[model samples]
Target: MDTELGYSIIPLAILGGAIRVSTPFLFVSLGEALTERSGRINLGLEGTLVFGAMSGYAVAYLTNSPWLGVGAAMICGALFGLIHGVICSLPRVNDIAVGIAMMILGMGLAFYFGKPYVQPVAPDLPAIGFGWWSDIPQVRAALEVNVLFLIGAVLAVVLWWMLRSTRIGLILRVVGDSTDAARAMGLRPAVVRTCATAVGGAFAGVGGAYLSLYYPGSWNEGISSGQGLMAVALVIFARWNPLACFGAALLFGGAGALGPVLQSVGISEGYYLFFAAPYVLTLGVLIATSSPTRAMTGAPGELSITK
Candidate 1:
């Protein structure tokens, strides 16, 4: 009976886990894609994500509103991005180094301020039950999707469209491709890059909010587990496309859920090894897509990593 149950539920478990786990990756990758499109890289998004998680949970606990917490997280994330953008805009400043510094700073600040709120109960984000017609508990659980995940999906489509069709998108593409050309065209690369970084930070903050207000649904330092950093690799794997980011995020999420899904069926052997699947997948993606002599296909011309 147990073995039979495992066979029946494994697919369902993976499906549910994929949707539930992909939200943060979706938001962070989208944000990073936008920033990269403008020829700037914000490694500091990890910091923004962690800080946003802490701030969102703290605000939710105090105000008793999860949405408010999300708002606060976005605001805070924007500020973190703004700081990174401004500093990197300075002469001889390395955006990558600044990003790393911001990550450490954000983590330190979150740890210091988040300590008091660690034990508090915060309001969690709501989910829309898509499995209401199902009689099976596992099916229902698998189908109940979070509102933020839906938002991220829609945002992915909208973002992809905007990048391809809007004036702002064109400008970002121009700036990303050549600073000299953007300048000749009367565009300020510094300003554009800075704003892009801030916007990316905002997206990452929302991702952080989802981490605390949904899924794991709690405030903790370890909640991120490097998902924030993994998003950078995810962007590369997606070839800097917002829509692709969504699909890639789901793939990563499914991989992440593989170990636990198998363990749910009493297949505990190599359970810990299963948890490493996402990282291995990340390695595989980087290896497969990366080449020493050529830029990745569809990569922005001005992207620092590509150069």
Candidate 2:
């Protein structure tokens, strides 16, 4: 029986699954990239992701509109970011400690508020049927790409362009590179970082909406599965570049799908080990990048150091 099911793992299946699973990762990493670009690091997005999932699921249940749910989730995520930004802006506060606290608060609130929506069916996000030209059912099924994924892809390109070309981007770059320089240029670093963090949160919310409103398509306590936390490491690997973040998201997504794909191909001898691929990959990346003597390459100066 398992062998018959395993026969279906192929390039088409892996590609489709990679796109589907990577959507959330892409969004979260992009959000964090933006935050870090503004000289701030927000580790609390894990809570925001879960909160957005819960909030999005609940709002969709109530309004019968998945988009509205997305909006609600964005709002929820923004609030968390705003809180983080505002608190961090105050003197003598540690951003990392605050992030940990915010994450705990967000998770607690999400679990409490999300309990009612778990059993209810929320509307699913619509998908574009790109598989129509394919003759094979498996190929067709694999090509049913979700609209949010396309949006995130486009967003990655746009973000990359904006960060490199726009005036606002220059201001952000200055702020991230040096608070004193921003002040010299009559720019307010706190304001820029706060806005950046809030916007970043909104993007993370959309990722959460993708979770509950599309893939998996349900509200549950375990819906997030550590994607948010993993995004922080992904941002590091991507060098805070939005385009790189997009590529890294796909890589992580592909890594995550390895287990399921192997099982589909009747390779059940080490089914459980395949599931460990993503985590193992993440650990390897962290280990490879670990250097105590110098700062991680490409890190924003203001974020990695107070001076």
Candidate 3:
């Protein structure tokens, strides 16, 4: 390879890593963003994510179609969210405690169903190529990107617009800001939260599907490693903005890829440290964004966790 070509490869590799690794974070973060915007925190998303991955992989393995798996995952995720929402809507149930319980339940269900799928070879999702114009071998190689990334980008823009300029978005914001205000305006807080949770769960399910059907085919216990939890932190760090979640997810993705990228470059020292980079970065951002002194300025007023 030419010197300049070799030099340019690093950036390309980083970009590839960002796209590949960020898919899960993007999905989960967006889901969390939606849930938080509706004035609830679904810590159970971790369970939803893992369970969705297992369900998606198993369905794809049995049916030989990745889309079916994705659909199934979404359904399962929505069901999980519905359960969480219904339980949380109860008079005195602590959302956090309920979230933890749901997480355990979701993971258990996933593991039980996932046992038979540990070794199955499943169909993978198709990727969209944007490298048609690139004649250079490295350029072509570097430009191979997933179609979901584009879809996610579009979703972010749509969500931003919806939140800023739509009636439904206004209702969600009002409900999040003040349940009394929502009630005074004839809006049902429980109904809105239920819908939001269900929608967020669907997104999280898609993220899990992406994990099993695209980034890594087949099912296994180790398919995920706290991507869902980190995504919850990411939503807080992004201040519940969909667009900011996208950027933050990309950054987390890059952090996640550091270990493997370092190994590729022949530096394997402190491998575990590389894996911890995303978590550490997330914690740092959370600390900076959350402070009693400043009172988490952009946070929705009705959010229990932030308050």
State which candidate has the highest lDDT.
1
Model 3, position 85, has a per-residue lDDT of: 92
- Model 3 segments more than 4 A misplaced: 1-8, 135-141, 283-295
TM-score of model number 2: 0.93
Report the poorest 10 consecutive residues by lDDT, candidate 1: 1-10
Q: lDDT by residue for model 1 over 31-148, one digit each (tens)?
A: 9999999988899889899999999999999999999999999999999999999998999898899999999999999999999998989999999999999777788889989999
Candidate 3 or 2, higher TM-score: 2
Q: Tens-digit lDDT track for model 3 on 80-136?
A: 999999998999888889888988898889999899888778999888777789777
Give candidate 2 regions above 4 Å deviation: 1-8, 283-295, 305-307
Whichever of 1 and 3 has more TM-score, that candidate is: 1
Using TM-score as the measure, name the better of candidate 1 and candidate 2.
1
Question: Measured by TM-score, how close is model 3 to the native structure?
Answer: 0.92
Model 1 lDDT, full chain set? 0.91
Best of the candidates, TM-score: 1
